[model samples]
Target: MVISLFFILPIVSIIREIGYLITSKIFGAKKSKITIGSGPKLFHLSVFEVRKYYFAYSWCSYDSLRNESKLAHIIIYASPILSNLLIALLINGLLAYELLGLPNFWNKFVFYSFYFVLFDALPIYYPDGQPSNGRVIYNLLRYGRKSDFERNDPQIDIKKTDEK
Candidate 1:
């Protein structure tokens, strides 16, 4: 139960992103969450980033994480990936558990499986299967770093990143 609860924390933390976007738009902060829509994605990207970071801080308020650092925001941006993977693994684990002749809460398994599988189909993802959010952007930028070089982030200007 304790182990299940610990892993559950990360999955549940995704709500932070949802709240902040809603917060910025409803109340307006760094800027108005919406734009004139010049038919360009960059406009939307800017708006979304602000809202995301805003909600990310909301996560902090929720005792979700210590703070919403640039790196943390990147993780928050890639949260859906973690969440999607978490759900898939959970479903697979549950199914495997059943196959192994163990028992779990059937109602919970059925409910989570359907939602997670559907969420896995959102309009995200870059050329790679990962979402085109801060975390994957960070990964692409810091592609060849050593394993110890851990804090990869896209909060830095992507335009300044050099391809090796």
Candidate 2:
């Protein structure tokens, strides 16, 4: 449980956030960042930040995209879910073939990876009004843009800074 909670969970969270970072970069986001965990900052380097409670939560933020289009937004929103799913599938396939060692560890990792994917793919708004990736994707397809609440939600949209 300890290994699953701290080691496997945080690694899976980072992988999920990397999905967002990579897709946002592909879409030409001028600035992008991945914040892992919550609470006070532990350290940050380049586009990644690790907080004190390093497995509690994680998120990705980016400035405006150069190719700002509905399709791009939809894909970006779906990236994390896709990434987690892909990892889970790949791991499961390997396990099925008995191609990887440390079966127990791999099983735990696969479980957490799917757990993240399942929750992230659910189309629901969080308590703080932040929409899940699935919710954002649904809105993008149904309305051609983020909903009014998402537009104003600080958690969803990173405020632009004047710093160079």
Candidate 3:
């Protein structure tokens, strides 16, 4: 159980990316790349880059950021947590079935899945003081438009980022 739990952590990042991909596709955005972890490439599973570091971080990029609605972007950002939460709920339900009662491993997996998703989706800052994904969305909701977002977001300068 412990060994599997250790293995599960790394895969969680992949699961989040899968969620992102699905949501992006549904919203008609083209995904350009997906990178899991943060180091030299261990290998390639198709387009996915499996890095030396695992379970630390993951990112998915879309080909074009232009012409996307605010709501669409919000859905793309929130998809990971939403999908993970769905999976956790599904597993929890399965575990509850009387004839198919699984062991503690499944229960623990569901718990960790919920924990990771909530951790990312919450607005709380990390140790490095970066805003969570949910916080980013909150900021976007507050700003309402790209022009406003660029004006307010310190990380994004409109003059520098403006494609026009």
Q: Which candidate's TM-score is highest?
A: 2
Give Cα distance to truth, residue 40, candidate 1, Å: 20
Error of 1 at 63 (Å): 20
Residue 132 miss distance in model 1 (angstroms): 1.4
In the range 30-127, model 1's lDDT, one tens digit per residue, is: 34333211222332364442222322211211223344344444444445445545555666676766753324443344344345434433434434
Error of 2 at 15 (Å): 0.7
**RMSD (Cα, Å) of model 2:** 4.9
Estimate, for each residue in 77-128, the C-alpha lDDT of model 3 and write its tens digit. Answer: 7888887788888888888884345557677778778887888788655554
Lowest summed lDDT across 10 adjacent residues in model 3 is found at 146-155
Better of 1 and 2 by lDDT: 2
Clash pairs detected, candidate 3: none
Cα deviation of 147 in candidate 2 (Å)?
3.6
Report the alpha-carbon TM-score of model 2 versus the true structure.
0.87
* TM-scores for candidates 1 onward, in order: 0.29, 0.87, 0.76
What are the clash counts of all predictions, listed in order? 1, 0, 0
Give the whole-model CA lDDT for all candidates, comma-separated. Answer: 0.38, 0.82, 0.67
